[model samples]
Target: MSRLRFLAVPAAALLLLSACGDDDAGGTTSPATAAPTSPAPDAPGTTDASTGPATVALSDDGTHLVSAEGRSLYLFTSDQGTTSACGSGCLENWPPLVAA
Candidate 1:
């Protein structure tokens, strides 16, 4: 009887230790959590690809553009040409001109 009892005690302890090591992968970020709250600064002379067709504060020849957040300015090389590539889903917070 004592021999059976000793074996049972060790077996129960091993079972208990094996059950304690479960860890799930890191949690995923939701859309709301991943979304950016502020717009990124645009370089001068370079058009904001994310803005709309409405007029932006570019120079007479479109050499520079300002960010909507008013945090920084962006510039584009004269050879780069005018117009921005930012459109569609990229303009959530950085909305383009609205014909005011």
Candidate 2:
């Protein structure tokens, strides 16, 4: 259990750290979690490939990623691990955030 905790803690911390931002004027900005890349056929769990990567920045509260047009992106708590459970049906109610 200790071994799992040791490894799990850092992994969780890294994910948490990636979402962190400084809330101040002239504060540093976190890099986009997903950078622009050519739509490749082999990539797993890829988003819409036809569109370009969305330019995201931390929200004013520095809690989450927002789109270039200033839309707050959210994740479904129901998503299993890294795989999104939200599908065609769920999108209508909780639309997935897509940006250019």
RMSD of each: 15.8, 15.8
Which runs in model 1 stand beyond 4 Å of their true positions? 1-4, 23-32, 42-100
- What's the lDDT of the predicted structure labeled candidate 1? 0.42
Query: Where is the poorest 10-residue window by lDDT in model 2?
Result: 37-46
Which window of ten consecutive residues has the lowest lDDT sum in model 1?
Answer: 28-37
Query: Local error of candidate 1 at 67, Å?
Result: 22
Computed on alpha carbons, the lDDT of every model, listed in order, comes to: 0.42, 0.63
Pick the lDDT winner. Answer: 2
TM-scores of the candidates are 0.25, 0.42
Query: Quick one: best TM-score, which candidate?
Result: 2
Per-residue lDDT of model 1, residues 1-100, tens digit only: 9999999999999999888865433332221111222333353334553443333343333444433433223332321233555554544544433221
